[model samples]
Target chain A: MTYVSPPPEARSRGWYKRNEIAVTPFLFLIPAVLFFAIYVIIPIGQSFWISFHEWDGLGDKTWVGTANYERLLFDDRKFTTSFWNNIKWLVLYLLAIPGGLFIALFLNQTVTGIRLYKSLFFFPFVISQVVVGLVFSWFYLPREGLLNAILAVFGAGPVNILGDPSTATYGIIAAGLWPQTAYCMILYLTGLNAVDPEQVEAARLDGAKGWRMLWYVILPQLRPATFIAFVVTIIGALRSFDLISVMTNGGPFGSTRVLSFYMFEESLSEFGFRMGYGAAIAVVLFFIMLGFIVYFLWSMWRDEKGAR
Target chain B: MQSIFKASVAALALGAVAAPAFAESHTLSGDLRIISDMSNPAPRAVMEGLAADFGAMHPELNVELTIVDREAWKTQIRNALGANPPDVVNWYAANRMAPYVSAGLFEDITDMYENGDLTGLDSVKGALTIDGRQWGVPYTYYQWGVYYREDIFNELGLTEPTTFDEEIANCQVILDSGRKCYTIGTKFLWTAGGWFDYMNMRTNGFDFHMQLARGEVEWTDPRVRETFANWRKLIDMGAFIDDHQSYSWQEALNFMIDGEAAAYLMGNFAVAPLREAGLSDDQIDFYQFPMIADVPQGEDAPTDTFHIPSGAENKEAARAFLQFVTSPDVQTEINSGDGLGQLPVNANSGVDADEFLEQGFEMLTTNAEGGVAQFFDRDFPAEMASVGMEGLQEFMVFPDNLDDILERLEDARQRIYE
Candidate 1:
């Protein structure tokens, strides 16, 4: 192979001059940066500050000095329930990733109208969560809903999907899973597009098949998609508020309250804004989220070092 | 160059001087966004008429009224106040205003109140006042009562019950006739609490209700237990609808509107919805809950009030609007806005409507005469309402667990008070 060097004029130039970058990129970045700071960063910092004080969002903020944190630890049952529910949500929600992968694989073939089938499978994720909550609520309605109607065919009585304390949260989580699983499927489909056909053929020749082949070969290649799916699912589980609000409003005796709903209930709902208490709940949630973020960053750093 | 500099300096001085004066002399000329949960025709008509009247009174201010559904309004009010609060907005009385007042989020209307700028000041000023400072004015007053169907009662040969037992007997008669006695929705859960509040108030009077609301009285207090016992009797008799847990208040109203349900124990605000469905006043009647008849008199019956946001740009204009609303003429105009026939805040305004409103007016005035107390939600605080509503709902469904429910409510109260 022959190698050619750059012209002397190009080689002579410094890094800044060679780039010739315009201000347009900075212009494009400005709006996004501004939005991020305004909506995300500032509110986060404000919530953290609020966690330290007793505020109702209206009155003079009393300097509570971690009193809220203390109360959340010892006094607030809703906080404990909300935190535990979030954990349940995170653990069960991850099932969507694998469920989505299976569906994607099954529908990956280039058959007639496979695209339409894929889209149809993805339709739940396309709708807003509010609509999904309404649909699921109707589906789970005690006597008149689809689930009950189906149960009636089997000669079973109506199930109180949203009324019973034990099953209400689980039912809502199931509703959440429907859309989340579809989202994971989309991610896997994209990842499968770039899979090496040659490698798969060689693996098949070597007698690797089904679960074993998938575990060793295809799964490893799909790690990036899986990672993204896990990350979003975790965040979704932690911030699960809208669906719970729409589906049940933490009802049937606060059985469905997640951390986000609990926080809002304390600070904003008919429950007078104990902003400090709400912030304390937020602080606890923040630490939990931070653990995952730190682990993710550390893993990335370790991978970079290994590559070097 | 000297002349040019002088001219520029003079123009700058004139601009500075003219700006505030221009702002002051102008009538409410810009957008007056009024955010309310008053979506029904009666309040909406009144609100629209107020805009027209205000426009006629002062042409500069253009009122832009935006009515949100009840739940949506709470979220909107918080966001709006946190960012850009409207000039005039709707709010509840007492502790509801306390949060906003303490934070300096509302304009102080003490000056206007003291100056007699708002007529009928004695009637509504209390609702808007916190710690002696006036915050907002009430456009209308409402009474909580049992709205029953006169046609059904007459058809069944029943008179309005005078005592708690009589009320129970009345329900029994309706039930024996294979009719559902009462309608309620526990879907949002608070609707159940309203029933509990009325029962407790009637059984133990305002002081006990206040004590319970404040968490001073245990939910299992004998008085409180009595309220539950009373509720249990009704529940045992199947007084309420079968599937109330799944119904919203509006959905329950559908039962009354269609004559499927005989009675609704609800606030006076409910009348407009019933009337809108083409039900005549002759078909509907109101009465105080029979529970309170045995108890001693209490302070002022609770009232819903509104406030001026602190960050409002048109503070003076808002003050003027509040004053105008409380005036006798405007109060009458507001009452007649859409046949809402709400009890006027002005004690002197007196009821001049058909019999339903007249009876409501008489009850409210008698309450005013007796004295007033903040409603349970307002008196106790928000945290209390949360656990309280839950306990009420639980008790409604599981009367056997009254002790456990009351104990939980007490625990919630203890934490909140601490």
Candidate 2:
């Protein structure tokens, strides 16, 4: 740090003037730091604290030690089902990345009305997730859905996609993917624009083409976009609450409950008042997310060092 | 013209509210904040009217009415009451209030009840009281029963069933006639809870039904099984509409409207919407759910109530507001055909002359010999009800899974009650 000598006007201002340069940046940082501590850091700490209690949200919180966590891990079938559903969501949701890349590649063309085609493909992301859930809810309707309508033309089903426990989770994920894939496609489209055509041409001259060209040259350049897509997808899968809430309400007998939705159902929803259990669920979800967060920070750090 | 008519109605209602207030010995002169859950079009009007008239009665008192959506208020009430508590709030009766009452969020209004300040409320006082002390006052309640197609019944030459055999015979006839006997949607799941309330009550009588609700009885108790056995008979007969799990209670009404189903076991609120949906009074009629055994005939009548938070700033005004709202005249006016179109909790108040309301009032007053129960979800603890309703829905869909469902509920009951 550089030492700043007191100016003539500040010479008689004591230690305050002597330390102005050193303290000015901290004064500027206080607002953001305060907000972050209050909103994010403090709540994370509070969640961990609350998890060890038996609170019904209205009453005084009773410290139950690790009982909430024990019940959540061992005895609660709903939690088990929700955890498995989260796994299903995580694995299935990653399909969007590849799906987006293919669509981005297909749309990376010089044709008439290509922009129109791209926008049409990008249309789902423009609308809200709630709308997507509703449209897909009707699409999977047992008797009068578009899915059944199309299937009937081929002498097949009247399948109740959202009604059956076995297929309801898949149906919701498919709806979520509609918009999520669009998001990834846009990310990749921007990445493809800055994809360094000179490198692509150089690879083509070396006889690299098609899938090989994509793997060796295109994908390497789209690393930033892929990185963003992977992180967002993971977070989206972990926080898969809204679509499930809007569509099934974690139902046909709690078959579609993920951890985020389950936490809400156990704490704040009409029947839920077990706040300690909910906080325990939240703490578990936070730890799960923390693993990815640490990985992201480490990767960023490595990348920064490489740049240096 | 519409605005003019609305103004006249408002003036008339406000006039009624104002007349009694002039008799109050002292004037209230502080901000009285209220959080109401009467967010429906008709109920919202009644709430706003109540707040306005209260403000009018106490000219110096600033009355604030914040109307939250009825469903959202269920979860929001705890936060609302636990924090900067309002002077008054809307909530449901029975175990639905247990959380707030036990948490000391609600004011104990027992002295008001004992002092004879709220007259003719003793009949529903049982609902407002927990541990021998009154906590709140009920403004309105509605009866739940089989709302059948009178036109269909007449066409098929069938009478309202009065016993288990007769009900089964009637349902078989309806099914044979190429229509379902009942339309129910377990999508939101409480509609199924209503069915369970009636079935369990009628089979084992109200006391045992209440014991089951209180978690004192096992889900696998043979007597509880007896109730399910009766429920299973109907399921096995395909007596309910197909894909009932997909529709909501409101959506299920389409079956009756289209003559695809013959009846719906629902609350009195369904009457208003049925009329709105183009079903005339002649097309629909009410009947209590038929007897499944020789038990006293219990009925499901869920009461909606109001309470003052414990930390209310203007409690004097809040107590006066509760008394004013539950007054016989006010109850009669608010529960009129033009208002909530339901039964008034003030026993002295006459119900609206609406046909369905009259029938429901009669049924709940004289015919409910076993007891009047707050519907299942309201009677049982909230956690148990949530898990229980889901199991009930699953049971309706898969009758063979009864053992598994019962085991799950028994486990939940043990854990929750402990």
Clashes of each: 15, 0
**lDDT of every model, 2 decimals:** 0.76, 0.90
Worst 10 residues of 1 chain B by lDDT: B15-24
lDDT of 2 by residue, A201-268 (tens): 89989999988998989999999999999989988888788899889999998999999999999988
Query: Which stretches in model 2 have alpha-carbon errors above 4 Å?
Result: A1-29, B1-14, B17-24
TM agreement with the true structure for every prediction:
0.84, 0.94
**DockQ for candidate 2, C-alpha atoms:** 0.74
Q: Which residue pairs show backbone clashes in model 2?
A: none
- What's model 1's TM-score? 0.84
Whose TM-score is greatest here?
A: 2
Residue-level lDDT of model 1, residues A23-46, one tens digit each, is 557867999999999998999999
Evaluated at residue A24, the lDDT of candidate 1 is 55
